[model samples]
Each structure stands twice: as structure tokens, then as C-alpha cells.
Target: MFAPILMSSGVSIQLQAVDYLILAVYFAFVIGIGFALQRHTRTSDEFFLSGRSLPGWVTGLAFISANLGAQELIGMAASGAQYGIMTAHFYWVGAIPAMVFLGVFMMPMYYGSKARSVPEYLKLRFDERTRAFNSYSFAIMTISSSGISMHVLADLINRLIGWDYTLCLVVTSVIILLYVLKGGLTSAMYTEVLQFFMIVFGIAPLAWIALRDIGGWDGLVAKLTVTKPDALHSWAGTSGTENAMGVEWYGILIGLGFVLSFGYWCTNFAEVQRAMVAKDMGAARRTPIIGAIPKMLFPAVVILPGLVAFALTGDGQGYELPTKDGVPNYNQVLPSMLLHYFPSGMLGLALTALMASFMSGTAANVTAFNTVWTYDIYQSTIGRGKDDAHLLRMGKYATVFGILASMAFAFVAAQYNNILSILQLIFGFVNAPLFATFLLGMFTRRSSSRGAFTGLIIGTFAALLYHGFSHAVENPLGMKGGWLAQLLGQPAAFTLGTELAQTFWLATVAFSVTFLVNLIVSLVTGRDKTDAELSGLVYSLTPKPIETHEPFLLRPAVLGSLVLVVAIFLNWYFW
Candidate 1:
């Protein structure tokens, strides 16, 4: 399975017989575990939410592991090389706070309500219309995101190993489908736990080897001084666009940290659904806190390779990134580094790690999609009063549909040359306003379902307008799409420098508009809920929750606070 294969790039995939054996055994073991758990999924609860029987430690790791997919692995590393250590902002500032917020504040409402999915929570708090809107949007988003994973895997295989793209896609789909169909959410989480370790084992060594090759931390800094002085400093030039990222600290904090971060970690069902499966409220609240630790450190693991690739390529060390049509492929940096450094057996393991990341991400999307589809959409709308066993079957069928939908979207995503751009655009449109809806629903008893529905629709429309106007500058209509830009007139010369900054700005505007719209409309249009009605749903109306009997150190507040302090220290240190 791991025999050497020559590629168009002229480097051999030097995977030996033992390496192939390791991969074969790995796949078989994963499938065996899935089959072993097949009987546990007879009920909808088991099939969709792992019977809500997972411990914090297990669910916590799986929580972060599910997110360590192609986007995190590929896009983050590429950004590290392109934008430098400032990319760490995505984790340290952007993720940790929202994650802690989810664990400490939000999980209570989510888990206490015993809602089957995120959309269901909205339905309970708002109305069925709100729930349907969210569920439908999320279903489309999950399949699209999963398809991007499939497209990424096929593209990488074809480019790196001279494999047939369609064949690779079929193989990957079959593997993911089998385990997911057999074991449901339980199996997906179990495999995610395993994939988490594989990601560490796969990428940590590459960082070590690359750093050693460059001499050490000191050596890396010294070499980067000549090749990329800007990349060496994370925050020094972030105040303006004079450095690698060209994004201001205000943009980084408000745009990335508060808006985009909260939007994703708090509202995105693919992530929130993981915590919803915890055995109890305590475990559910602790899940993201536990997940936050590894999330904060992963930048060092994945980004280091990208930084190293930059150093090697800059130094003419035959580590140049692959190109298509004379444009350099930054996404290939990690794989290129793996090929440049690892040999034979190690190479195979690294490859397996990449594949593991892809599958883990894809599985999470598929599982989340199926759960929401079955409980939120199918059962609530089409198959009401269904038995548990029947719902379980529906969940299985939804999984297959999710996978197939993703496969179809993968082909659509392939037509676009820039996957990251499209991904960010989707996130901006869907997540930014969704967060606004949830924030109002949870914090204030006055925000009615009408307000939420209106806010979501208008907020998403605002995001689309921003995106349209931003790109409209190049259109023949010019600022016609955005009369405001036309009123100010176009600049003679300028550059935003990166798509991220643009997306950040767009999401920020959308979020602000949505929050205000929700607030004003909610205040004017409806009666507020009584404290009795708002008990566990609204923050101010709810009583302080009783503490769990777990040890002080293991307690959610203690751990979450500690994680926050560590995150603060990292920002300070990096700054």
C-alpha cells in the first residue's frame, strides 16, 4: 500500500512495505471499532448524540479533533507562511475566548434545554420558522464544507502522488461512509480521538526536524531576518498594512476575535453539536474548555512547517512550492516540506496523518449534517411522531445524503481557484448574523422570534451586499451595487492586501447591523418573557447554577479561567 510512487513533481512517495502495513492496520482498526459500536446505535439518541454518555475528557479531545480538519491544517499552515506568526491570532484571540464562553456561559442553555441540535435550541427559544431557516442554511453549509474537504483530498492526492482524482475521491468517500453508517456519532467521535493523536504525531516531528535543520529557534529567527524580517514579528507592524498580514490590531480583535470567532465557535452546529453529546451538563460545559487547550497550541504544530517551508524556499533549498499556471501554490507548503524532509516509513505516517485529518473533518461535517437533518428538519417537519428506531434509520439515510451532497459540492468547489476565499465568504454570510440572533436570544428575554427571524434575514442580506459591493468595484456597474461607495467616489489607488481583512471587515459590519437590528426591533415589537418563562434560557433571568461536586481543579470555572489566563499570556508573549 505504501510502495514508492513517482510523481509529476519528480519526488517519490517513498512509502515502504512496513509503512503500507501500518496504514492498512490503521484503517482496519478504525473500521473494527466502528463495527464494534454498531449495536449501540439502535436508538436515535445513540445514533445522533452518542446516547449523551461521553465523559468530558473523551468528548473534549474529540471536540478539537473534529475541527483540526483540512481547513485548519491546510489553510492555517498556508496563512502562517504567507502572513507569519500573527496568524496565531486565529487561535489565541479568535478561538479561545469564544470556546471558554461556550463552555462557561452558553453550554448551560444549550445542554440544560436538552435540545437535540443548535437549530432546535433556536426553535425552542424563538420559533419554528427561525429553526427551519437555520437548519436549512446549516445543511447546505455542512455539505459544502465537507465537499471542500473531499475536493482538497483529491486535489492533493492527484498533485502529490500522480493518483487518479476520481478514484481517490471514491475511496475516501467509501471509507468515511462505512464507519459513519455503522457507528454514527459515537464512532465519529472515537475516530476523532484517534485522529487528534495522529495529527500531533504526524506534524510535531516535522516541526522538530525542520527547526533542527535550520539550526534552532535562534537560527530560525536569524535566517528569517534575511528572507522575511516582517514574518519574524507578530504584532510589531500589525497597526498598519506595512507587514505580512497588513491587518490592524483593531480589525484583528473586534473583527476576528469578537465577531468571527463568536460566530463560528458559538453558533456553528458542526462544533456545538459535539458538546451537546456530553453525558451531563457538567461534562457538556467542560468540553470546549478542554478542547481550547489543544486549540491554543496547534498553531505551533501546523504553522511551524509553513514557516520552515518559507525559509527553505527563500534559501533556494529545493523546497519550492508547486505552482499552477505560474502562480505559486501556498497550500502545498506543508506537503512539500514533508517530502523534502521525511523518508520512507516516516513519510507514510505523515501521509496517513494528512489523510486522517481530512477524514476526521469530513466525518464531523457528515455526522453533524445528518443529526440536524433528522431531528431539526426531517422529524420536526416531515416525519413527526416517528419511533426512535425509525428516526435512527432516518439518521443513517441522512448521513448517506450528507456524504453524497458533499461529494457533489466538492465538484462545484473545484471550479473556483481559491477555496479559502469561498470558505470565508460562506462563513461571513451564514455565521456573523447567526451569532447576533443567538446572542440576543440568550442575553435578553425581550428578543422575540420575529426579531430573530428578521435580524437573521437582514443580517445575511447585509453580508451579501458587502461582499457584492466589495467585488463590485471590478464589475462594469462599479459602485452601482453599493451607492454609498459611489457617493464617496472610487479611490485612484489602493489595496486591501488580503481576502481575510476584507472578510473581517464585512463580517464586522454585518454583525453590528444585525445586533442593532435585533435589539431595536425586539425592544419595540414584542412583550418580554416573564422570569418563570426565561428561567434557563435568558442569562439575567436565570438563577446562578449550582456547582458540580467535581474537584476544584477539575471544575469548569477553574479550568476555564486558567485557560483564559494562559491565552492572555500567549498574546502578551507573542506581542
Candidate 2:
């Protein structure tokens, strides 16, 4: 059964005994690391936040690795094939600056406050209402995100090797569940660090081999120019909807770059939780900046494969993009490339890497979800006044429940062809409004808790209404939005050219409404917390993080600046 065979989908790669050996060894190592770390997770703190003892580098890799899951692997390649180099905007414009901002500016407060989760920080800075809203919303988002990762992995395995989808999902989830249940967040982070290397080594070769097979960059470019003229240039024709991305400069910058990007990197607990677990404030501050280094370079391996796959199609070699329901299924591009290029030994390694990516992301989500559920939701409410031992026990229970919940959500992910679009829509509803609350909560002491809670509710509703009334021109008036428009018998408020563009605009609207409402409500409600109480949580009230003692190269500011320079250069080069 382990031996690969030809499938009805036309996938022809076959795995040998050596391939099974590689897979067995990888699974052993993953589970072994969890057992080894089991002793360290004796208390709630260790289980949830890794005892806040990890060095910058470990947390840094985990930070990026957690994000380099199905979204980065499958969704990104899909975007690259669909939109070409414009997909790089997700990294260059949407990720880098936010990471730098988190490291250099936000980490000081997040780390210094000693909050266990992002929602906990809201509680410290604002009131219980703000924290409760965020905690519930975040828990839902994390579980949904984890489910998407699970769905992607199961789909890949079933399509590639003819495994039953349900069997794949059960086996993969059990593996992830065992490790996380044994070792907690420490296990997850260490595994993420290992997975990071696996993903790099496993996937990087595909880019190089694909480029070589397509006759290098110049040849690929020439081929794309003949078929998709705008595929090679990042910024060309982006001034209006004439571009392949269906987004203009202002929308890209404000909607994606500023609102959606900052919202996720700065406030999303799954990514920020990795940084918060660092051994000290300095390590925490540098964690995201360090992660930003690899993040900026990831496009070469992740996005390039999609472009190569596109260019290879119709070259009279029988290569074609995988199709579902007579349309190109962009989500299969990366896995399809793996099947097209890798032999038995390399195939197992690459497949292991793909599995690792899914586990890394799923584990990250489960860990974050458990932490929030145990500390923010449970302890703060039903489990209030619980001792450390009780909380620790509850944390373990939360881990089990979180994974089960995620497994249930996997079926929901199957409804979409591109996972990233659904994820962005979710973020638009959750993260976009939450960022506005954080912006007001952290930056200004005058922002009342009432203001934050009120703004969040209104902003989230605004996003729902906006999404309901608008949709991409290509999508029908249904789950993708414009439902309210159809119901009201009015034209869509805005008809964009792509689902991604619609999500970006949705995020922008959410952010704008939340920001404006927060300011308005704060002005009406007046201050709630005193300056002394807000000292560590508020920017101006907090003391500057003194990093002078650290080596210059290791300083967060220095690292962030260097990352920004590299990011700018990449954008310029690609543009």
C-alpha cells in the first residue's frame, strides 16, 4: 500500500521501498522530539508559552514556519499561477513591513507586558469585554485555519498517492495530536524549527529543477510573455484593474499592505505567540525580525514553482495544470510539480516536507487555540481562580479539544478551490477589526475599553455587510458575497475582478470603519484606565526598550532595518 501507483488523475510518480524508509524515519524523529520534551512541560506556563525560555533563533524559525503551512505552500503557488509575480505582493508588501514593525515596535509592549496571548494583552490594556470578544473570535479563526491546513494535506496525499482522504486526515491528525499532547508548545515550536529546514530542503530543489527544465529564468520569462504578458512583471499595469491581480496601487497598498498585512502579523496570536515565547524581551523583539529574513526570500521557492508549472503547460510535452470541474485547480500546482519532478528517494523527502508544513501550521494553530481557550476563555470565566496545576490540566484538555474542533472544520475547507481566498475573508472579519482595537488600545491611553469593544462589534458587522453586498465579477452572488445586494435587488456596491481583490477591499473597509469608530467612541466615552495602570501596555506610557547592551548586529532595530532594505530591493528588482 505504501508503494505509489498511477492514478486516474494522471499522476505517474511511484514510491520505492527507500521512499517508505525515509517517511518512517521522519515520523520517528518527529514523535521522538515530542517525548524528549515531555518532561519540560510540567506546568501551564511551559505547556502554553514554552516557559518563555526559547532563544531568538528557535522562536524566529518557528514564527515563520508556523506561517509557512498550507497557505504558503499550496495557496501561494496557486496565486502565483493565477496572478503571476503579483502574488509576491503577499510577501513583499503584505508580510515584511508588518514583521519588522512587530519586532522593532510592537514586541517591546507585547513582551514587556508579559501577556500569554494576544487577547490577554487586550485584557491588560483594556477591559474584559475587549479580551473576551477577541479570545472567542481568535479561537474560531485558529481552528478554521488549522482545518484548512488539514484539508490541504489530506487532499494532496489522496490525489498524489491514491490514499483515502478520510484515512489520510485521521492519520495525520493523530500524529500531530500525539506530539502536541505530549510536549505542548515546546514540542510544537521545536518541531516547527525542524519542519522549517525540511520544507526548505524539500521544496527548494523543485524550484531549481523546474527552472532548469524550463531552460532557466530567461526561457521561462519568454514562454510566459508569449502566453501571459503580465506574468513576469510585478508592478506593470497595476495602476488599474487591467493587471492580472485585479487590484490597483492604492488598493494594494492600503487594503493589503497596510490594513490586512499589519493586522495579521501584528495581532494574530499564532505568529506572535512564537515571538512571545522568547527567553527575554530582546530575543522576543528580534524573533520576528529574524523570521522576516527567510520570509522575504521564500517567494523564489514557493511562488516560482507555480510560474514554472504554467510555463510548462502546452509546451507539447503533455504537461498540464490539474483541473477540477473543467477549471484549473491552482491549489494543486505545488504538489503537481512534486509529482512531475521528484523520483522515489527525493519524492519521499519532498512528501515528508509537505507533511511537515501541514503539521507545523496545524500544531501552531492548535497550540495557540489551546492557550487562548485555557487562559483567556476558561480561566477567566468558568475556571476562574483555578490554581496553576488545575490550569495546566485544563490546558492539556484544551489541546485535545482544539485538534478535534480543527478536524471538524476540515470539511468546510473542501468547499473552496483556493484556500487563501477563504482565509483572507476570515481575516477581514476577524483580524482587520481587531487590529483597529489594538492600534487604539496600545497607542493611546485615552481609548476607553467601551470604545474598543463598541468599535470591534461595529467594524466586524461592517465587514459582513460589505462582503454581502460586493463580490468579484467572476464569482456568483452567494458565499463569495453580494448576497445582500441580490436580496435587496440592487447592484453590487463594488464588483472586483478576483476573490482575493474582494477580500483585500473587505479588509480595508473593516479596518477603516473600526479605526474611525474607535476614535469616535473613545472621544465620547472618555478614559477608563489610568496612566500608571496602562504603563507597560500603552506605547507612550511605557519606557523605551533598552537594547544597547546587545550586540549591534543582533539588535531588533538593526535587524529590522536590514530586513526592510532587503525587502525594498526585492520589490524594486521584481517591479
Candidate 3:
């Protein structure tokens, strides 16, 4: 029988001198970049949006790196192990198309309008109430996301190297705070580019070594098929709800692929802020499309190790998953793989890569948070007549507040086994409604501000109500849902077989309700902004972005189309 690796108050993995040296070098470089960029971030614009001066390639990598945090690394690996190959759908189906759409269709409106942030764009497009609602919701989401990254990194460090979890959290938070507070968004973006490369180089070799040990793809398939026949196929058994993921093709497409994916890539300020900093409209439009290329291939590095670990466990090879309460702690899959496969020098690089990822994510959130709080909330409300100098000062202060707030939320993140599920639930409440509001506001000028604001309120509540009444079969109480059902002394309205399914369906409910309610209210309330006022904000009134001077290959439409084709081919190949 296989035994799980139980957590103890002792160090599990030891580092050699070379490992310590590598780690020291990485920390030095990280802090050095912040000080190097400090001279350029003197103004509010430079501090908040990098002075709109970065190249497409830099912003593009940062765009994806900002997202490759605990969610992509730890949560994805956990999903890969638990749900099998179907987890790739998160990238191949849910992310790529939305990224292409953002590049080809949405960037013109966002970059053309001169809005500093996404919530500010809403203010320009609709009204103050609509922008306020989005700004506060977005602020909450960013803090929560940053906290999740912090929690996961601390947990990994505690598990592998036996550091005190609280110490790990405080130390990492301080490092991120110092860098972001010094150089601002410019610092965050440049370091994100560095982190992107570190993550790729650090983790790719582990996947290669794992595959080699398993005798390659065919060998992995042979082993998994014996225990999980559907693990090797992405969409083979997804037609119904009996699959490993407990989601049907429709749920995967509509809930994750359409609603959740579009909601996030199109509306979230953290990712969009990366593209907004590009030097020109052309570059801005290409940012997400460029990021799509690497995003399509990331599953191999991040997800494959989890699948390999699952296959190796309990096969009499003396490997087992770390366990909590006698259940597999899938969150440790990536760190576990790093500890198992890498030597001292390599382990340092891998750990630095993980640190880079967490920092990248946290910095993105903090920068976006500070911008929205300074411009959208503070400047708009309390500090209406503040000069640029004052606003810039406040932005730095907000950065400090954002990191502290994220630290507080880190403890909240510790309650969940798979961080992705909790994140999706948050997105279901926040992004799902926001996407509906953006869709109506951008595509047509008929959406009234009151209608949009009301829709967001009702839509957010609808998601909460649905989640409260729904439960995953295995996890039926509290964070996973069913609390309201318990309060009502009745069974859950919906019982999903998996936590992933429940979150997906909750997003679907939120989007559907928000869309319908917004449409109806807009029809009733009539147009709030006239055609002249909606110029550059609404798609129909905005001038078509011309790319005749650029090379055909560099055009956003061409690049977006090519990305879609490759995404389709990938889905077909994996199918």
C-alpha cells in the first residue's frame, strides 16, 4: 500500500551552497531591476501605465506572465492530476480565442479612448455609477488574486524547505512590495518579462525529464489507461457529465470557453493593463495575440508533470502525493516534482522561477489595484482637484496599501485545496457580470448607464444565489457552496459532480442573467450617450484601425487569425 507524505515541522529538502548562491543572485537581479527603473517612473502616467512607452513584445510577455501565477502553475497542475488531460481545455479552448478577440476587436476601443484603466474606460463609455461598481469589484478581485499567489508560494516553501509559512509570506510580500513601490508599473512590466523567461526555462526541463523517465508519450498513455482510460484524451468522454472533469462539452464551451474566458481576458484590468502600456495602438492590439502563442504551449510544461506524478503514484515506485487529512494535496504537484527531479543548482533555478511567477502575478495585481484606486476611486471621488504630483504620491501609497491588503487575504486563500476553483468562483461573481456590461456598452450605444449598473448588481447577486444553492458532490458545504441550501433546510438546487463544474455553471448563470437584464433595461431606459459622445468608445462609431503601413504578418487581424487557426489545429490534434 502507498503512504502519503505527511506535513511536519521539519525541513524536507536541503539546498547546497550552489543553490543558495543561485537564489541570492536571483534576488539581487530582481531588486536591481526595480532600482534601475526608478528614474523613469517620476510622473503619475509613468507610474500607472509605464508612460505608454513599452514595446509590444515586452508588454505581450508581461501580459501572459501576469497570469501565469499560482493559478496557472499550482492550480493547473492540480487540475491536470485530478481531472486529467481535460484541463488543457482551460488554455486551448478557454483562453486562446478570447485573447485573439481582445487583440483583433477590443484593443482599438481601449487604446483609442485614452483611458488609463479599464474602469476609467467604463466611466468614459457609460457613466460614473457603472465605473464605480466595476472599479470596486475589480479592486476586490485583484487583492484576492494576489493573496492566492502569496498563499500558494508560502505553502510550497513550507512544505519543501520547511520554512515557517508566516515568515515565507511576510518575506515574499516585502520583496514584491519594495520592487513595485520603487519602480511602479514600469518596474512591474519589465520584471514580468524577466519572470516569463525564468519560468519557461526553469520548468520546461522538468517536464522533459519526467517524460523521458516515463518512456515518452506512449508510455504515459499506457500507464494512465490502465487506471484512467479517459486521462489521455482531452474531449473523448466530455460529451456527458460522467467524465473525469464532470463537465459536458457544452459546459466546457459555453461556461468556460465562452463566458468565463471572454469575461476574464476581455475585462480584467491586470492583464489588460499590460497591453495598455504599449507604445502605440498597433502594438497594443498585438500584445494579447503575441501572448497567445506561448499560452497555447504552456500546458505541456505545467500540466504534464502533474499527470506524470499521478501516474507514478501508488505504482510501487515509492512515490506518493503529499496528503492533508488523508487526501491527496494536489496543490503540491509542481513543487513535489521540482524536489524529486532537480539537483541543487537546478532546484534553485526552479524555485526562483516559482518565486518569479508569484511575484509577477502579485505585482500585476498591485499595480492595477493602485492605478484603479488612485484614478478611478480616489481621484474621481475624494481627490478630484489633485495635481499629477499628488496623484503620483497617492499611487505609491496605494501600492503599499494593496500589498498589505493582499497579505490579509492570504489567510483566506489557505482554506481551499485547489486555488483555481476559488478563483473561478470569484470570477463568476465579478468578471462574469462585468463582461456582460462591457459587451453591451462596447458593441452598441443603446446600453444606458443606469441599466448597466443595475444589471451588474442583479447579475452579481444571481451568481451568489446560484452558488449558495449549488454544491459539488464531494464538497457540499461552505466554500464549495450549499450554505444557503442548508440555511433553507433543503437540498441543493444543483449538485455538480466536481468543484470545477459548479464554478463553471455559476459563471454561466451570472453571465446569462447579467446579459438579459442589461439588454432589457437598456431597451427600456433608451440611449444614455449620443453618437457624438460615444465616439472612440463604442465600436460602431469608432474609426476602423488601419494597419496598411505595417507588414502583413504584423497586422493584428492577420496575427489573430493565425492564432485561431493554430488553436483550432491544437484542439483537433488533441481531440
Regions more than 4 Å wrong, model 3: 1-11
Q: For residues 1-575, could you state the per-residue lDDT of candidate 2 as single tens digits?
A: 33333243535456678878988898899899899989998999999989999999999999999998878988888888988898999999999999999998899899999999999999998889899999999999999999999998887888777689889889988888889988999999999999999988989999999999988999998899899979888887888889988889888998899999999999999999999999999999999999999999999989999998998987667457876666676777787788777777898899999999998899999999999999999999999898999999898888888888888999878877668888888989999999988888888888898889899999999999999999998888988899999889888988988887899899999999998999999999899888999999988988999888999989898989999999999889988
lDDT, each prediction: 0.83, 0.89, 0.89
- TM-score of every candidate: 0.94, 0.97, 0.97
Local lDDT at 147 for model 3: 93
Q: Write the per-residue lDDT of candidate 3 for residues 539-560, one digit (tens) a residue.
A: 9999999899999999999999
Off by over 4 Å in 2: 1-12
Query: What lDDT does candidate 2 reach at residue 464?
Result: 93
Worst 10 residues of 3 by lDDT: 1-10
Candidate 2 CA-lDDT value: 0.89
**Model 3 / residue 297 / CA error / Å:** 0.4
RMSD (Å) of each candidate, 1 decimal? 3.2, 1.8, 2.3
